[model samples]
Target chain A: MDNQYIEEAYKEGFTVRFAVKKRLFSEQSEFQKVEIVESTHHGKMLFNDGAAMVSERDEAIYHEMIAHVPLLVHPNPQKVLVIGGGDGGTAREVLRHDSVKECVMVEIDSSVVEGSREFIPKTSCVFTNPRLRLTIGDGVAFMAETKEKFDVILVDSTDPVGPAQPLFGPEFYGNVFRCLNDNGIVVAQGETPFYEPEAQRSLVGIMGKFFAVVRPYNFTNMTYPGGLWSFIFASKGLDPIRDVRVGAEQKLGDFFYYNPDIHRASFSLPTFMRKNLSGLLRDK
Target chain B: MDNQYIEEAYKEGFTVRFAVKKRLFSEQSEFQKVEIVESTHHGKMLFNDGAAMVSERDEAIYHEMIAHVPLLVHPNPQKVLVIGGGDGGTAREVLRHDSVKECVMVEIDSSVVEGSREFIPKTSCVFTNPRLRLTIGDGVAFMAETKEKFDVILVDSTDPVGPAQPLFGPEFYGNVFRCLNDNGIVVAQGETPFYEPEAQRSLVGIMGKFFAVVRPYNFTNMTYPGGLWSFIFASKGLDPIRDVRVGAEQKLGDFFYYNPDIHRASFSLPTFMRKNLSGLLRDK
Candidate 1:
């Protein structure tokens, strides 16, 4: 009688909601929650360990856009680092590049990594790859001490809250710059352009001061709170947009997230976003 | 602590969820319900009358993208018909065109119109304009009997559900084709490409059969379930993409939503979307 109550079980607890209109998936161990009345495309997921709101059903968009942007720009990226992406989605994408010999994922929350491995099998595939090294530590602190420099560093932190807030600050960015090679590139998940214009602008402004080429790219993810989200790539040298190259022979079959065409399309910004960037740059 | 329970209010013994996220309104009325969350951006609102979720701040993006696309494409859009948009946001945009001499809106529910006018004042401004005419009737039925042709027809209906299901059917599109003059364009709120790829394909396929030119456009509305939502535009004669023209002199001051640059940019679909469109068209 009560449509609101869901008997679904998640990693944290029983997935109980007053109402769940659209259930994309409901199995014994996993479920996806799409709010009947309002939702972004990818429904919120209830896994055995934790819950994550799917910003997009096709994770290729976010994973490819985030990882490839910086990876392509930094030529000869042998050593790469991913921060806060315990789900291993970013690391999975990072491993796609044959040029990369080593990848280290530093996620603060071990539970998220464990949960992702158990529930989100698509993302968990990254861990099974021999090239990836998983580290349970604060990314900010990890970057501070690591003398071993990476050619590319990806801060795939959650929304600017909890452990992710410091990642947005200038100090963390400076550390990221220090921990990277001279030609290294760093990319972070910037918030939605529609909702957090100020935050986006500020982050861009801060990164511009620290990096030579600070470019922001737009991607659409439905599962996130807002329909449109952005990611900012700050590099010491090359332009991500200009230097991007996808090999014809490279394994495109394994990729559900990134491709050559999307590589170009993701960089296109709407008028408001372009205006915000111009205004933010002008203020600098 | 319990964020799950949605309080229902009985209005004349009619049970309704107290949805209240309207920014134009200062006071919390009985007809509105508001949801508060740990959102980095503007708070979300769901208007009860139209069963529409309107973010307190970002309704402009949805309204502007929907209204301006078709309006700008038709060179001399004088008579406009908006179906199922009780919120009056699309009408507000339709009235913005100086070339539009008359704008008629047919809404199925009079309560939605009244509630929007009371709570969403900015959107309701269109109704007060001298060129606007409001009609409460079944839009499909009205289209059938009326010989009056429109330069632009904006199908601003809810998701294909409840009363709006008829709007997505073949008969309704046939009526739309008849109601439009030569060179007339129609814009409908298609669902998200990620979540509702089939819905978009269906609409595009149906509209493509009736119209010479059919294209799908996207906008980022954070309040919507998916971060990115798609809208399909079908023109009887003109190409929605190539036909767009906004004269420099006609350009108004500071539009937060739609502009000439964005007009071109919105059509630039990602690889996934492009593939979807191509596949759909090839199948046809």
Candidate 2:
């Protein structure tokens, strides 16, 4: 099985291949195709719509980065909300913060959660956390109707395609903006700026219109398209740079990637990205 | 050949595959096997002994990072020396600086220079520069005998395997140290820390013993395994952080992946890396 590899057609002409050890499970849910495969390079992996989402090997980097960046920014984030993180990894990282009283994860697809729990249990095990409330519904609709406001809202959607396409729209960001308190924060998984430039540009463009402090940061995620992946943080009031500090909880334990230095370092954009950003922000 | 993809075994169990368009050239040189292939995703690619070295698309990132970081650190970099960068991308980038009076490239393999000049003409055309002197010989031996000191020595070597293994030793580093001027700087391609932790640790360890300031930084090279790739900078006097500036040449044109903020940001290691570095530096 060393030669037998699963290739993901990420962009039109680009693809990333991973050697598969075995196919644990594969099924098409009502929303999208879900699969769990153990790979020779990465550990147990979960795929939604044939796109690699989370792998047990480097899941900590993505999960810790998404949850901690904003959580650390807000001085006191009592309540948090996560949209489209069906794999439960985001919820797990969110639970690490002692300041968070409640974490509600609204995932549109129920099968992704079931498959993740069954196949990629390492990241999906957060379902048992007492503070977590898993809500199976459209994240946009949930955010629009919710009366409660959050200190941080992490939009851990898949790439802007199929069920996740709506998550990147103006309406969705508007809903997220309305669902946040003053000095609240929202961090969304911006697509690869290199491979998926349209997705990255459009998301950052839209987010810039609403938030006072709109910043994007990047980290290497091997499971993703270009390996170089981006994430956007939009704050209503708090600035990620000035407000964020090295929290005690973050210093102690399970996080293998995110730290105080990385939290700051991730904001530095390379020249190509700087060019894209300089042009994009100037237009906005 | 849309479906035809060439895969390189980067490590014992890990591999990275690139969509191939055509096989440009293949030959067994005196030092190593050299191949030039056009890829569907990455324009043109050069490989040595079945290991991917550079691709046209993201080669600027690697080339700019290795050359500009040190070139910019030196107040006035007039004399520059590059070892093992037969692809000529390093020379091309180094020549971008206006202050460079002489750019000497010491390549161990004459065939690599020939192949790169013939096949990768876009990056290799720097050979035509009046100030450039291409020396085809063993870089280790050349550095040991050469009395000409340089402001910066950019080592753009392949993985420390086969012919390139000797370049990573202490004696070779000592030669590089002696070949550099009083305020000299040397930046080496220090393998992938995530995948080749032993290589990264040893290289950093060896350099620390010789240089007054030693720093290891990493960036995403999609062509490389682990996505995370490391580079070590050893300076006799100047600190890359305190001394390096975004120069006029870097800001003018052609550079796609390096900038002032990135220069500072590159030194900020991630937590996983910080842990490895912290403990390793302490032991030394």
- TM-score, every prediction: 0.80, 0.95
User: Which regions of candidate 2 fall more than 4 Å away from where they truly are?
Assistant: A1-3, A246-254, A282-284, B1-3, B246-254, B279-284
Q: lDDT per residue, candidate 2, B1-284, as tens digits?
A: 13376667655355567878888888898878898889887888898988888888888888888988888889989999999899999999999888999999999888788888888987899999998998988888898899999999988898888888888899989988888889999999988767777788888888887888888877786677667787899888788877766465445476688877887888878777776776444211
Candidates' DockQ values? 0.25, 0.61
Which segments of candidate 1 are over 4 A away from where they belong?
A: A1-58, A72-76, A246-251, A254-262, A270-278, A281-284, B1-50, B246-250, B270-278, B281-284
lDDT per residue for candidate 1 within B150-221, as digits (tens), equals 999999887776667788888889989988998888999987776567778888888887887777887776
Q: Model 1 over residues A1-284: C-alpha lDDT tens digits?
A: 25433322221111222234444343332222222111122333433222243322556678878887777666678999999777787898888888899999998766666655665677777898999999998888987888888899888877665557898898888888888888888888988786577889889988887888887877875344344778887787677657765573154354443556555656667767888888443211
* Docking quality band of candidate 1, CAPRI definitions: acceptable
Give, for candidate 2 chain A, the lowest lDDT window spanning 10 residues: A275-284
| C-alpha lDDT (0 to 100) for residue B172 of candidate 2 | 88
